[model samples]
Target: MSGTGFWTPVFDIEKRGDGSILMRQNDPLTDHRPTLADALDHWAETAPDRPFLARRAPGGGDWRRISYGAARAAARAMGASLLTLGLGPDRPLLILSENSLEHALLGLACTCVGIPFAPVSPAYSLVSKDHRKLREIARTLRPGAVNADDPEAFAPALAALAARGRHVISNEDGPGRIGLETLRGGDPAGAEEARAGVGPETIVKYLFTSGSTGAPKAVINTHSMICANQAMVRDCYRFVAERPPVVLDWAPWNHTAGGNKVFYLVMTNGGTFYIDDGRPVSGRFDETLRNLREIACTWYFNVPLGYDLLVEALEGEPALAEMFFRDLGMMFYAGAGMSQITWDRLRAVARRTAGREVLLATGLGATETAPFALACTEVQERAGNVGVPARGLTLKLVPQGGKLEARLKGPTITPGYKGDPAKTAEAFDEEGFYKLGDALRPADPEDFTKGFFFDGRMAENFKLTSGTWVPVGAVRAALVDAMGGLVRDAVIVGENAPELGALLILSEAGAAMAPEAREAALAERLAAAARAATGSASRVRRALVLTEPPSFERGEVTEKGSLNQRQMRGNNAEAIMTLYDGGPGVLTF
Candidate 1:
């Protein structure tokens, strides 16, 4: 499919004398709203009765919606209540809950009243036994107020924060807890006064990075950064401005992809957002499938695994496929590299169902770039091409260890990490570009505008015994794709060894097979992959299947399900040694 009406794909590239390259879009960013409050006010006045947010009703018969005017009123009253409780830029609100109507309202209230808020991942509270990360986050922010939708479910986490003299708010009334209803009854005039103080530079929120390596850093997000990102989004996906986008997304708001990108994408475009109460997991994915059958999203986003599951459903159920692709303008995947099998399946299913090709694309960005820096809008035969930099941003590709390391400077970039001046200083280079720590390879070396492929994470790639650098990201993706359906993900090992090895995480299909059959299947697949590999640096000579999955609490896996390669290797040192030793259960290629 051509990005004829969707994208204005043009770029200006420059090669520097210092062996670096700079790239940016030819056009400039158009004017955008100074603050999110302005967007809420505009939509409320113009489209009073339009549904702005929706969620599954308690019993799940129908969707309960909140209109633009009603949402604005609720936000104003909540903002007034927040101010009365002494919440502001310095002492922000800390939210520990999943995506819900109340969560959305509380976030809007904070933006409206110039009170910076941080919505943390629910896993830190619900999944962890020790709540170590939660305690670290509380210490970092020193928030004055905290909110958890269900006080009973989050009682332990709330107690941990309350011990530090933080105020607790919940939907249910309890001893020493503020009820959500009480916040909704505050005077709107107080909120209106607070809104006047908010400007472009005012802090909107703090989106914490995924603490894959260590404690998560709080990335400061300002009103200008988010608004400029939406402007760039509109310029690239121009069809969104033609009509209000209808999105049903399940990605947690704690991350930038959903928090800043998808959330504001709906709000800034005057679109309707359906908070999906489903996840891309075994038991939870059925809810997502049910929701997709009912809501035809104009713009859809998901991880590669979700697309793999979705393609199976779309191919089997024609009615569900019809509803899904009915008004679908585009499909986007990120967080991991998608397999060519899944990519081809999605395109074929869409063509068979819709009778026309739908744009399937991906991008590359970080939490600091508001997560929309480089987006691919053009048609492609396979996945892995993250297109050029967006408008209003300058991408600097600096030479680093045989790869072009990506660094960016732009209005959409976060100013710095909260309360960590030293770490923040290390984040940017002397030229004032935020170091992304990712390496890129141009798709077409002769034509820079063709876009670039994610080479690998600079920190993850390592040298082999022969001094050849092994790109772990590429090798891992290739291995998983080659394994067909036997493995879900692979952790590449052999940092200083003669060749590469992998610790495999089995897929559902692999786990269901008999022990001997599974081993044979793995050996056959690994041999085939090794034969097809380009060189020793890319080949996997041996493999061992991990009996246990990556633990969230152990920091082996991120909330987005991307494995932390370093953490995984460190946690499984014994397994690596066993694989190299050709021990029992290790498949030798």
Candidate 2:
């Protein structure tokens, strides 16, 4: 049944002093429009000279910016470049690159025309050694142009495809490859009119899922879906004409959160987008710190691990904290839930620096729905409540068998994956709604308007020997949240074991300082957290903090730096047994 056309319920979202529900209002925007093309057209006509992208080199000197006019011109030129290569709407562009100004330009260009561009993980280009998955992707979509962010290896990766000969373009050119700069130099771009009459329903980009657990699927996105979501997100954040926010972000554009959501949010609001070349891991994070030292940004977004490291560094230097908080409006976070310890530390530091609590908000989203479906916006808190759905989004949690499953219907939802109608057909329900596959029971289901926490994926959740179904994602998140800096991530034991156990990996920094002593201290803290855990269902009764790194040559760990859980367990079966049976470092009673 069609529930309602549009409804925003104001239910009790917060808890009162007496632990009762407190009324929190949620009113959807009255002027919700659903198209990215219209938003850009409006912004271009209204404020053409406003800086849309502000970026700098690694050393953090002066910022380079591109205005609305320049952005539009570059997009058209790139679109012209796509057509010059004999590409069309039928065949999508395969972009394998990192987050950069050029990547953003090409993405916007694809939207200008009806040509769909799919940006795959750079791991597929440089990291993934197997090449099986990358080869499979090439087989599915015989890409016309492969734009490798890297100049050296990217061209070769694209050339690995059989029919991909003579159509590969590299942003960099050294030995023998076509350069992106070379393409933009020869043409005045007379193909601007060819891109006219493009509408919201046009397929803009195809984003592949990370597939940490299994095979990746290309999530198709359209202009209408992203633009509509962008409108609601921009309005909710109050990014409007009068006062524009300055953003300092370094998240990979391959992910929809950074590419579609934040990118469009900045463009739609006419704000300045300062692109950071730094990454969360490696020595690049130092570049982020150096960048923060120079410019005063209104908004900053990063992952929880990145935030923790930055905060640790900020505690030592007050001058750095001064530069950070000088004109900062809010510090946004995403990717993973902020642990309670991390959240508390952030809140304390924010209060110390800002003289009040500066909000650290996050959201729940996927690559499928323009990377933003739910967020914590209206009110500020450290807890994990991803707030209500956006203006046009309609969420329904249907109980199938015994678990509550979440389904969504809106313009922001993707039409389907590129050239895979069978998989796409399996993704939706009978009512034509996109099946999210994950379950979502209201935080307090009695008062449904309070919003919902993401229950575990239906496929991932498995039943214990006692016949009790375990929500893996929620339990994993909760345990990791409790462990904080001591454990980087975990492998939930007790799949067939008698009791719950964990294979813990210490944070690199935490492990570096007096490794043995730190492990001892962490063992005690972990024991305490386990003892304090709510129930036996998820509690990690014993844990083993892994000291040695998983070998890359053995394929136990991927080049993307993620552990293959099943492989890891098999590789370290003795340690898993030790942790399971409470053998050596079992500090908990």
Candidate 3:
């Protein structure tokens, strides 16, 4: 299938009399498998030897492949073992590690036999000084078993959790750990019997939200939710059915974007997934570049900053660019907005390398939605048009604070967060639609088919002393863009204040400059941005260079690098006060 043929854009929109809008895809969603295990069974039988998953060798040589048949066999054995260890829906397994073969197999095993497993973010264990979030998750889950790929590396976190009688699984044998081989030594007949009990309503996994706002809530993921989500994905990106998707992804599986969406996308389609060990950061991104040079993904995904770095690499290296665009069906970005600069550069690079423009798209969904509700496949000239609602979803846009608050009702939407009935009650509306807490603006007010742009987060936006509302998401994006690559991100603060101020997180370029030069450059850029703004609500009058990066422990940033504007503002209340007080180091426009 050609890149342009990936999606056929069609939407059905209805404007209600109550100043609300409803939208959905015209095409109805097709039947999907009852469970993801069903898909695994089918693929293992049909494409036994085909590579379903691959990862780089220990020291990074060639890709080590796991065939569908091998995966199914491992799942059965491991599933039986988990059952033997008294793990089930109530006392689930908790994974604490980066993406690895062991992690994938363990997750698959849990899903196959209806044992709900939670892949907690490794940062909570490794990066945090106190492992506070990890302990919190442990308390919430009360997991029967815990798997840490390297027992030695995660020993401190494991100690913090104080796993006394819990089953400890690891890649290598340790003092009190069960090795992967031991898990794979169980009887397959037991797993078969357990699999018979698994159905659509069976809980598959628990994907925890980044606890930026508060303690991470375990979003309940069921077999039905994931299978239906993959069905929606296949319906939209029809090319996946034509040619099984070949994806190389690095997004952590703890988030729904990766664990449910991308992970199941490959499994349902019988596609190959190359687990890229590289990340988008300075030291780790080179591994991604090296992987891209060898593997050409049919469908690609990255955050905006990842694309920014990738475009730079692609522009400078022709071979890398060619390899990247080859066999590429589409590119996707989420978690944050892509700057127009990065968008244009990516399109240009693709056109130059592949002789055509590939589909560069963004979408709006959340952990509760199985993260595949509304996707934009249209070749947008600019960024932030999150297309229309997918089939099997009813998108409700309720007017609130001069913006449309996006809500969704679908099979893909999670039933509720686990172990928190109060939070779940607050999540849905009277009509049972999950409120996204995000506001959207129609790309064209007269035509709903033109798609919707992410206006801002309703929770993030605040009013100034002048009574004008400031859209923090939009303002922060504009400020980062206006800084001309000098600022990576910003926390906008001006709730009930005379004007807006920002705590700017510097980009690599900005950080490398001398203190005086950096201050001057930021001041000039801030002046330019203020002059360009049409109102006090949008203008940022002052800013302070945030020398310290957002801390994961502090809930100032997510694993995907999205800033918690509310948390940051509260964490740096003194700094924000200084900006308003015209203290030293405050750069005024």
**In lDDT terms, which candidate is top?**
1
Candidate closer to the true structure by lDDT (higher is better), 2 or 3: 3
| Number of colliding residue pairs in model 1 | 0
> Residue 503, candidate 3: how far off, in angstroms?
1.3
- State the TM-score for model 2: 0.87
Give all candidate RMSDs, comma-separated: 1.1, 5.4, 1.5
CA lDDT of each prediction against the hidden true structure:
0.91, 0.68, 0.90
What is the alpha-carbon lDDT for the whole of candidate 1?
0.91
| Residue 446 error, candidate 2, Å | 3.5
What is the TM-score ranking, best to worst?
1, 3, 2
Give stretches of model 2 more than 4 Å off. Answer: 1-38, 58-61, 162-166, 172-176, 185-189, 239-242, 378-382, 400-403, 513-516, 547-578, 581-589
Q: Which 10 consecutive residues of model 2 have the lowest summed lDDT?
A: 1-10
Per-residue lDDT of candidate 2, residues 1-589 (tens digit) = 0011112345324443533232333555445444565566566677889888877854565778888777777777777777777766767788887777777777777777667788776767676666666676776677777777666566456656547343666675546556767656534354556567576677777787655444567787877778778766664565333467677888777778788877777777778888987777767789888888886776788887788778876787777888888777667787665677877877777789879656577667677777677765533444566666666676655675357776666777888876688988998888777777877656666765566676766766665667666676677677777765766776666666556767777677566768678767777777777778777667767777776776543445543344555556667888877776667764443
Output the lDDT of residue 580, model 2: 60
Alpha carbon deviation, residue 176, candidate 3 (Å)? 1.4
For candidate 3, lDDT tens digit of each residue in 1-589? 1135555656778889989988877777899899999999999999999999999999998999999999999999999999999999898999998888889999999989999999989998888888877888998999999999988889899899886669889997668889999899999899988899999999999889887766889999999999999998998898888888899999999988888889889989999999999998999999999999999899999999899899999999999988888898999999998888788889988898899979999999999999898888778889888988888899999999888999999899999988899999999999999999999888889988778889998988999999899989889888888999898999999999999999999999999999999988888989999999989989999999887898888888888888888989989989988989989899887
Error of 1 at 546 (Å): 0.2
On the 0 to 100 scale, the lDDT of residue 164 in model 1 is 50
Looking at model 2, the pairs that clash are: 200-224
TM-score for each model? 0.99, 0.87, 0.98
Scanning candidate 3 in windows of ten residues, the lowest lDDT window is: 1-10
